[model samples]
Target: MSEAPSASPHTPLPAAVPPLTAPSVPPHASSALLASLAPLLHEWLPRQRWFAGKGRPVDRFTLVSATELMPLTGSPGLLHLLVRAHQPQTAPPSGSRGAPPPADCYQLLLGVRRSLPTSLASSLIGQVQDGPLSGHSVYEAMEDPRLATLLLERLRVPGPLGSLRFEKEPKADVQTGLAPRVLGLEQSNSSLVYGDTFILKIFRRLHPGANPDLELPLALAQEGCARVPEPVAWFEGANPDDPYEPYTLGLLQPFLREAQDGWQLALRHLADGRDFTDEAHALGRATAEVHTALAAALPTLSLGRPQTELLADQMTDRLDTAVQAVPALLPYAPGLRRAFDALRRLSSAGPAVSAQRVHGDLHLGQALRNGDGEWSVIDFEGEPAKSITERRRPQPVVRDVAGMLRSFDYAARTNQPWNPEWAQRCRAAYCEGYAAVSGTDPRTMPELLRAYETDKAVYEVLYEARHRPDWLAVPMAAVQRLATT
Candidate 1:
């Protein structure tokens, strides 16, 4: 309700002493309410695009933390939460002691009211039959402009809203009360565009420690990389119960209104049977620039025999897993292993390469081409299927190149006639441009590049089989080529 203290630094609050008001956290009317919403959430969460643990059944819902942004006593109330979803252990990740860890913690923003309008029907979670507000209705808060605008204001002020911490960049001059609307994009996260000024990405799946999306962009911006948008403000879960634990919930950045989506642009070119060599070359140069900046800003390692062999082993393991899930990949498994074996052979020959923080999941969809024909990469969050720690790991630059190459193939296949020649041309041009800028050609390291591409294709096979069955043939086509040649 008041401006932040003048004495407070513009930088993010340290893990130590933090200044703020007493937030309306659990002591308020929310615990009973959370208990009431558990059943509703279990039903609704699985249907959403962003929910990570899809096929797994939710065992229970644990209220990790709750913050009443706007109490239900007011107009339309806003409740912020970090709830952990417990699910059956399938093939769980490493590092587990006594019991299995929680499936995932989600950052949910819900709008509470006594009635839901016809327009907000799509946003509905369900009417709460029991809670603090016994007869109240609830829906996604971000879909409501009033609640979304209120969120921006909280970030603008930069202070404590209970266990939730809203922070603004020191140099960022954020405006108050900008009109907000949801950005309609197929992503694992929800985004709100505020009057073409900024876009706020609310992470539906919450994780401890800094998210790579926020961390990588900040690192690149510091390196004076113009290929990524600078983060303006962000909010995190400031757990009063455990102040030491960190959780990045959302990120806000300046919106690029005039930039054309790279995926859409590629699809349009494919549909028209146009040559995309020039654009592909320029995009490759842009990718090189981002990679260069990331190397300059962060840590880099010399990956030798040990690393390469380990990488090859990892690829083989992933391929085995994929074959188990998608039986169509069974026949190609032996052929795919050749790529990994080649990488191992190269490693045995004493070929060493550089490893650094990469784009992790670079594709046509993750890039944007401005009106001036300049390329800007977006979403540094890495692969959606990976954990935060995995996303933060350094990998070979060719891994990113491999992803974009796969994307070119996807674009060509998605178009009616499946133009492999166009994809081949674009791939070559992209590598040429990259070599020109980075002083290293990924094509020169054919074995390593092929290994990464095969690894990615294997991942795609499993993902498509689980998520989009109709798109199974797309990656299977690539599998056929990679398996044989």
Candidate 2:
């Protein structure tokens, strides 16, 4: 372990270069063992999609808890951990406020083996030397079938791992000894399919309270909503911050083996030059059905003029931030502000609007089309950037409506000849279908819907700028349209 060498001013440095030694490790762990693994973790973490510290160096790891699941028995040993990762802090921008807060807590599962098979080489985290685990190759356990199966087995039978508790919902029957296959497309969490009958989603970043992903769906299931997959079993662990409330770690639900994601389905229709209006209409009805069920099951509120003004202010603030991050939005900022202004004025002129929990982040990708051609909404995690508190707050249902409209526009614009007319048809048809089932037409609230759409487009602009520079044009075009029309 040595200090990182200073780079020359003329040379471009990589965003993150791990220090020779780990900044910190589990307090109670064998110092030598953790010391040996620290360097490996520093290098392995940033490469993972679920790691929050992308483009930032991992300064240290503070262990919340660590438990050996199953020690080596001719195969790899299993270890489960909840660790807080601290990234290197940078000074705030000029004229900004206090320093950025420290990092997030993440779940880690490690497989310790003497040597990895050639097939498992890609999963290697690093090797250990001169420690309790010396001469072992430690890799992510989720990648190893044996370890993954063991995790499923733990959930199949109600059990406890140290402070962590695994429990099944009443009436849930999870089959044991099912084969596990890792899902590769997940970004923020790891999911495994068990025999194509059930899927277990392991939440990587641990949140203090109950995650809405599980809470909402479990409620929906109890309300007899068939549009969402119900949680069959879940796992949680003791939270030091709130001893009364445990941190949700993972959820198991029935797998929709015959379902196709709506994004792909929309793309298929676009590729065939076929109208997606019918499917869009059906999806709208499904969305309305879910909204009704949620309203019936959860607390609903009314956003009075003052609250509406505050909401508009928040939208304007978000626009200001997006404009700052994506300078291309500068030209449209004024027009977008006007939309929010209109919303504020309109709200003051009318009675308070009903507010309830809607899908915080809704898009085509969040919907799935079953083999029966019915649409099912999935992933109630909300916007990843929003805090758990903000996401769980009640909001106007039109927010979800606006999100879906924007997604339809995205589908149209992603193709050549950018068919706004097609998007218009689908959007109108969707609203019509929704109105038929819900008895309230989203299109009737023109000003509010416009404002939400503008907000969503601004959010998309910033997102595309940061993650997919090539896709930046898509949202930018919508921003221009919103600003002018």
Error of 1 at 300 (Å): 0.6
In model 1, what lDDT does residue 252 have? 96
Report the lDDT tens digits of candidate 2 across residue range 350-391: 878889988898889999999788998988988765667888
lDDT of candidate 2 at residue 405, scale 0 to 100? 96
C-alpha-based local distance difference test score of model 2: 0.83
Tell me each candidate's TM-score. Answer: 0.92, 0.91
Q: Tell me the spans in candidate 1 whose CA falls farther than 4 Å from its real position.
A: 1-22, 27-30, 91-99, 239-245
Per-residue lDDT value at 458 in model 1: 91
- RMSD to the hidden true structure, all candidates: 6.0, 8.8
Per-residue lDDT value at 225 in model 1: 96
Clashes of each: 0, 0
